[model samples]
Target: MADAPLKVDFISGAVDYRRRQGGGRGQALPKALGFRKGVTPDVVDATAGLGRDAFLLASLRARVTLIERNETMHRLLAEAMARAAAESPLHGEIIARMTLILGDAREILPSLKPETVLIDPMHPPRGKSALVKAEMRQLRDLVGSDPDCAELMRVALACTSKRVVLKWPRRAALLPGLPAPSHQIVGKSTRYDVFMKLPAPAGHS
Candidate 1:
């Protein structure tokens, strides 16, 4: 069979610098998702986008796999990773721990077993003002709607052995019909809905 094509773009010097900075002064979703202390489980970032969240998870020591369906975003993220690996000492180690996948989460999420699966589908912007970052607006234009978000959530919940966390706008209703989160946290403009899986049976190790 023909090999699946590579999805990410070649890393640019500038963006690579930013990725190594690893969320730097930017607002990171992991912190707001109540994973502030870091995640001990393996994680899959279903909406990888610019990879800020994935980078943060890696920095926090989670073995993270970043999934981006958009070829453009994948390329951009790849370029950023490349830049970081070349310039920053800590960058290479972090990049070593992250796996980048280019595909729909529905197709990918089921095949992997992660301790946690994270979803941060882009919601329609509440405003056309300056508060929304230009890069984010551009990203929305490129990736479009999260129409499959509900389905993606379903697959993630079934496949993950630990938990599935959904990040939503604070005002939006919870995803239809999934078990309510085992817990939740309201951030400045968003909320994290955590769904926990049953624990492993004793001596099943």
Candidate 2:
């Protein structure tokens, strides 16, 4: 039989586990997005698949807007978030920090700008990602292959004033034709390529 259809449960399971595990500014995601004491920036999760990163940011006290382009996935995320919100005071508090938008990110991303934008571009699974493979397949099922990630990258770059973070497999090749990142934060299996807005040239403004 085909793998079981994905069921999103934000209240319990891995979501809850992560919520209770706790984190700090030194974590890869937070550090890449420039998190610091007393500086929890508003963030836009451009490819808000499953709301994992978005929720993680919210759990860290960032106001996060999650833009998911797929209708089914959006509905699933909406339901999961609603359930989580009603589950308990803690989950409700984090859910309150997240706002979900359904539509093509490239078309709507410019309007709902946030200080830091996060994109986890979808690519074919490369190696032994057994534990993560299910979610990867769910991503393929939910959004299919993302041919427009580069365009979304462009939109994110144009609209974000602070920074845009692209999450990629640590060893994977960077997307072609894009400018180099201002810096990168690499972990064991993942990396975040951070592109910050260029400062105005002298006398330009």
Candidate 3:
């Protein structure tokens, strides 16, 4: 018989990620994005290298669409997600909501329609305190730098029906030609650049 799925450890910060977040138990996704209270939004995680962010989103009850291009990384993410689903108490219901896709974000993002599109491309870390984590280093080995991320941004901006939030280092420059974002949420080492879409044409509900 096949081996049982791996066990996921919620403690030790083993399965938690900094970027991808699920709905907090007592907390909810920010209300501005139309996320119903206690209801997770369907998220398209375009760069699912290690699935850390994706897993966090799942933990928060967000229905995540994880996209990865590297064959090996894809396999690892699938295994990890499976392990978490089977072993995590909070994941029983969350797993059903996540969908994994292996391909370029540029190709997958255009085909998906979610309340939000979250992008976390690999950029240079600013300081020693901002160094990449060990897990992220492993992922970097699997998938190199996101050199084509500018193009991916273009595609995401065009395809997202609601908003596109790019997670970037606070010091990093905006994607080429992109204007200042409608909103920005800054953290210690990272910032979420939120671009809201033009409202749907009037008279169309």
> Which pairs clash in the backbone of model 1?
8-74, 8-75, 9-75, 11-79
**Candidate with the greatest lDDT versus the true structure:** 2
**TM-score, model 2 to reference:** 0.92
> What are the lDDT figures for the candidates, one per model?
0.75, 0.85, 0.70
Residue 31 of candidate 2: its Cα lDDT? 91
Candidate 2 Cα RMSD after full superposition onto the native fold (Å): 1.8
Task: Report backbone clashes per prediction.
Answer: 4, 0, 7
Q: Which structure is stronger by lDDT: 1 or 3? A: 1
Please report how far candidate 2 places residue 33 from its true position, in Å. Answer: 0.8
Cα displacement (Å) at residue 184, model 1: 0.6
lDDT of 3: 0.70
Arranged by lDDT, best first: 2, 1, 3
Residue lDDT tens for model 1, 1-205: 4333333322443344555566432234554333543335678899897776677667666688999998888887888788767856777787877899999989988788766889999885776556886666677778997888998999998888877888888888887877788987677887878887888799884
When summed lDDT is taken over every stretch of 10 residues in candidate 3, the lowest stretch is 3-12
TM-score of each prediction: 0.79, 0.92, 0.79
